[model samples]
Target: MDNSNSNSNSNNSHEGCYFNRLLEYTSDSVEFYPSFKNSTLFTAGTYQIEQGDTEYKERRKGRLYLFDIEKDNKVKELQSIDFNSGILDMKWTHHNNISQQYENDAPLLGVVMSRGELNVYRLNAADQEQGERRLELVCRNDVSLDPSILTLSLDWRTDNKEIVTSYSDGSLALFDVDGGAVTNRWIAHDYEAWICAYNYHNTSMVFSGGDDCKFKVWDTRTIEAEDGGRSNSSGATPIFTKRCDMGVTSIHCHPALENIVAVGSYDECVRIWDLRSMKQPLTQTDSLGGGVWRIKWSPSDNNHLVTACMGGGFHTLSSEDGTFTDLSIKSSYQGPHQSIAYGVDWSYTNSSSTDKQQYIGCCSFYDRCLSVWTP
Candidate 1:
């Protein structure tokens, strides 16, 4: 059987591409769902960018606008939330099993404000009559060691009832919505914690990275309760910790594999580690120039990973060895004019169908745009 011919035919039916411009021209964020050919792109400040709304009114000045991308590259206004502070990061939770309880409800959208307040917003179309969406304060905790919350990450737990956040002050906290409290908190590192990712394959595992020149792993199951604590000789309580050498910029747990992690660092390399052995990385490679700012493992395949470098271009690395293939985004009306690549996501298409082909989605720093690439 001609596998190439078979693969090509399958991809053609599933693969689609489009772009949504952020309402604000700043370094904003974008997420896409290609099967729906719909996307959400928002910027810090906001105005309104509707068709023929105003000739040249700035839509990204007051509110963070969320627009939905339709079939014809047309963006529809979905919802808008005004913030006294700018928006940091936003993630939509996938309703794997939680949708059963809500019945006819939209997935929850988690947002981290510039002031370091993490808020969870449940999209409820059931109450269109209220004309007002409810903004539930899931859990609010101030993580200000220097009066600045550099970055925050929010990932849903396996139970989908709780979320994990990594603060700038080198702290990791897990918030339970049902309990209305932070169930666990640990000072996993000594510097700014830039990223935190929960391994869905291994629900009890949490991975974090930061400016402390280390990427540490913490087992959520080993979290110390309010009273069950014992201190070491130095009076430091033992926490489930494993450290890397350089300041870690980004981290992702292998989607399908258990306990395997990909950590990108300021050392311009990506390190793959195993939680079972904490001595050293299982594999390491210097594919990213300047520094590997962001790295992501393919959700569809555990052996494939992607990296975004600081000043250099992006690279697709093999999980077998640390070898990588460089990818260049075309500057044609879309991108590569952007300075650095910051965020990357994978879009799996034709879920109900048998096709398994998926494309990588990326957004960069300077020129605010989104690009999709496939092997």
Candidate 2:
């Protein structure tokens, strides 16, 4: 896959660093728990199952693996847990205030199971009888009454009190983290709702993209499922919507900005948008050479955006004043993984404000490869 045809408005002269393999394992998704800043600890969900199959059969192929990011750039596996089908996405709840003791003194994890459910887990300590050191199921919320309706992705609401999940059946669900129940749901797309997120700056706002090629915005406060947790009624209509050239696959709300969101699609382009005005994209980048599967904004730097572009590889872009102009590869075809880049995440520990270098965790499907990109 030659990348000569693409255009990145800025020179990608990687003078001081190069891509290096920090781990070798087949994984479908990877995420770092911010609470482990002193010693970075992350989780990797394996496989990339499609649709939904017999849960009892596909469950054997899905496993969530834990790894610790070491001081010397090497990683070690800490533990592993079994599950029903592949994990399409994993998100650890973030803490805005460090003093509050959360569930089991650890951040809660919500995983999008390809078997049509969103499962939450808590990390328990393996030694002192604390649960934060091991992955333990907290609760399971099945978005669809039908077990085969796979959930594709999920996002933690800005307050970390609720969750919004996208499903393969073209619907969305709002799950309350503390309540461990689906508060609301509705049909939001004509095709698969590939991705969804709550705008960080607005508590009542949400955005979704689907295989139907529509980018829609909703006012969560006003959306009421016409029929208990399932509906296509006018009561659930989105506030704003626009069509994309292709299926929208990924979306990430900026951590520190208002009305700013980055969206990626099957068209292989990344677009920056200001939620206030959706008539046109604020900025658009050249083709990334593959389907953009997942996206993450640097926790410490909102200007930096990372994405897993299936065949093209993983990328890090510079977004200045909402413009994603300086695009560069953190890992690509010339590097590791040789398969569909299904998941990627930025390390909060190394990318702190005082640190100049950044570490990224990425996983590829099919071949099941997991690697860290060290600068």
Best by lDDT: 2
Residue 120, candidate 1: how far off, in angstroms? 1.1
Give the TM-scores of the predictions, in the order they appear.
0.68, 0.83
Question: What TM-score quantifies how close candidate 1 is to the native fold?
Answer: 0.68
RMSD of each: 10.0, 7.3
Taken over the whole model, the C-alpha lDDT of each candidate is 0.53, 0.71
Q: Candidate 2 clash total? A: 12
lDDT tens digits by residue: candidate 1, 177-291: 6665566766766777777877766667777887887666666776764421211111223334545567887776655566677778878778777766767777777445647
* Model 2 C-alpha RMSD to native: 7.3
- Model 2: residue 72 alpha-carbon error in angstroms: 3.0
Candidate 1, lDDT over the whole model:
0.53
